[model samples]
Target: MPDGYSRSSRRLSILQCVLFCALTGGLAASGIVYDYSRTQELARQRLEHTTDLIAQWIIGAFHASDYLLRDLSGLVDTEILQHPHPDPQAQRRLTERLIEKKDSLPHAFLVGAFDRNCIVTHTNAIVGFDASERSYCRALRDDPSAEVFVTPAYVNNLDRINVTQARRLESEMGDFRGMVAIGVDLDFFSAWLDRIDVGRAGSVTIVDSAGLLLARKPMLPEELGQRVVEPRFLEAFASEDEFSAIAGPSPIDGVVRLFGIRQVPDLPFVVVVGEASRELFSDWFWRAVVSTGMIVLLWLLSVLFLRNHLLLVRQRSQLVRVAHFDPLTGIFNRRHFEHLADLAFKHARRAAVPLSLLLLDLDHFKPINDQHGHATGDRALLAFVEASLSVLRETDLFSRWGGDEFVILIEGDEADARILAQRLRAAWARIELRNDQGAPLSLTASIGIAGTHPAVPGELDSLEKLLAQADAALYREKQANR
Candidate 1:
């Protein structure tokens, strides 16, 4: 009878061991899956953020060149064209201005109606072979409406280097005059892109009008002047959306990456990319390694515990939150703002037109924080962001640029934007609120708007110059109110 009792007890113990083992395995799988899923989400978001930034920056760069060309077109006179072409001295003067104003852009080429072929001018010391005999020149010649042309990234035999930003030239008679090209150093832009927080082995590329590779980061010379994408990128490019993604091993690195794409709508190119690093589940991935080692000897059930409970839900949530929206206002954050801005900037530039960047600040609102409380201040900001969103076009960008400042990128010309701004100001005036003392409170906002002068060329397409002017105006307006 005692033997029988011992046998039954042993059987029960074995059953418990089996169940515990299964549970441990489940928990560990959960953690791994949770880590993987969250990491994937983070990767998606990081790629999206990167796509947006590059798209906007590239868009600005192209638009800057466009404004420069359009302004130059206005500068051309029948007097200049009557000579049948630009003299060497006039050409030198124009080249210097292109370099001086657009340091990122180091060269300019023009093919005028009076010339048999396109003439090139550059800031660099690569002399001779003034014409691109490539298909870009032929394409420009064939397309009559190709008013402002950008050729694909091409390897120039003259300099043994790649030309990054190249546009077309038109005659006073609006003939398929000549192709104007700019030689932008790929090294400079590659270095600039590296400064962004994209993980190891990320790439940023500029393709030309014919869909040929121009500049690539992490330096893919083998892929240079080659067509890399499988037409998926061009399909995405055809749409107005600024951002897109594909999930596959990159042709360059062979690493499985969430590759992102942002089209330079102003140009025929798109920025291709991939991001590095995976998100941490709990900052204890390695700790598990050691703990598993300890458990191997003890035959502990730690594995079962981990596998069941710690998987996908937490990681996915964390990554999605970080990637998609702003932490402060619970709104679409700067990352997303840039994504939308790139799209808007492209459309504006494509039409060979102008756009506006509006900077807005709450008037004397800092005192409200001191007078009331941070809690009240937060509410005011919430209300303010919400109200301003109402006044913007669907294509416009609205973002809280930290603290009391906000920025809006309007998809319209300056005059139309100012009209919208005035309307927003009136909305701000209508808001009524209660302070900490439960007393009625009120405030006004000062807005600064910056727009490109239609006649003047712009070397940099950024809000800084405009914001500076707007802030100055705001100071005067603030002074008047006082």
Candidate 2:
């Protein structure tokens, strides 16, 4: 309706909007995928990070046992024992050294070689020699290369306590000398495990090589000394590279567990197990699902709202144009011409500037309506509107005042305004049209310009005053031309 553009332009615009909205579905799906991928990567990284911290802690604790044991060697060999024989003074010194290490180490008892003579109930109890009859002691006494032997958790004659580390005292020739073993109390891990807050269902379990449960948080007192490796251990221990797996339901515990494993190389028989529930995954996954659903719903509502808004904008533009513009010439009618001038006057007053208004009326305009016809006059008006607009910049407003009369409002630049007025006069001189009877018509517009001059402030009372000034100028110019 505005610029003689074809019907195809409107259809293309509507199609493009529809196509753009259609692509949003794919965009939302991509967002969901991106979120899920990020969640997985983050979870993996956090799992590895947690495993590393715990593994290091276990290694540090294991080495701490070794540190305490090194002090025992100094006392038992040098200060305490009368070499090759047990003495009462030797027992006192060994007991003193063991006592010193008690506060520093979690495991703080001594086991000595149970010689037949030294095996009596109360003569002198060595730290390592709890029982000479067991397979654990045999491993220490017989294996010549086993200078250090950490035993599996067993039902001990002394209250069935589980020990993580044990050391042997043999001669330099790799003899199976009597052993000095300490039962590392599981209670020491209680404080450290509590400090690491890995969540409610998440726990840390340290088991020996024989799979005897060493220590764990929220520990099952009945499950102590029970083996972790099972007919279903494969489910838990997925791969050496796979640090974690969802273990199938335990026949022992009857609950499903996701287990993360870290091999502790420092301690001979230690595997650190991080276990959590399958329900934890469901809890997090459902949150993401609900979040995604809400997001999609919002996006749908947004598309609907934008479509409606765009349609409303197009309708408002059409209504405003129809109400303000003449049907024959695509420029403002007499009513809107006055409205534009009034708006400029208000703006000038608000800004405290001098106002100028221009009113242009074509010379010999009605004569063409007579000599050729009203059709020629109509064409002349259309051509005049086009010629005027061609010379106007965005800041300049051009509108048909009525009949063959037109108006222009120029702002901010007087030099540019003068240039546009000159250009408009030249264009009007070139305009030609044919009447309904096919007679030729030639035209020139009597031009006027109206605007505010920057230097003069608040000079005019109204935009009508400025228009009157431009009309007087137009009448004078037209009379001189006649």
Number of the top lDDT candidate: 1
For all predicted structures, in order, the TM-scores are: 0.45, 0.47
Query: What is the TM-score of candidate 1?
Result: 0.45
Q: Give one digit per residue, the lDDT tens place, for model 2 in 1-482.
A: 33323234445556765666557666766766777567555545555666667667766776777666556544454222333436756565656556666556654443333332123111123333336566556765676666555555666555656563555665666554444445556564444566565566666666665666766766787876677767445333333443554344543455555555655544434434434555446555776687668767776776676667657656766776788887788777778877776777677767865544567888888788887778767878888888778777766667777777888776654565567778887887777766676666777777665555534555555667767777877888888888
Clash count of each predicted structure? 18, 11
Cα-based lDDT at residue 420, candidate 1: 89
For residue 460, model 2's alpha carbon misses the true position, in angstroms, by 66
Let me know the TM-score candidate 2 reaches against the reference structure.
0.47
Model 1, span 273-352: residue lDDT tens: 66643322234456556555644633454444443323333454446656856666766676776776666655655666
Residue 161's lDDT in candidate 1: 44
Clashes of 1: 18
Stretches of candidate 1 exceeding 4 Å from the true structure: 1-6, 78-145, 157-159, 164-181, 199-261, 276-482
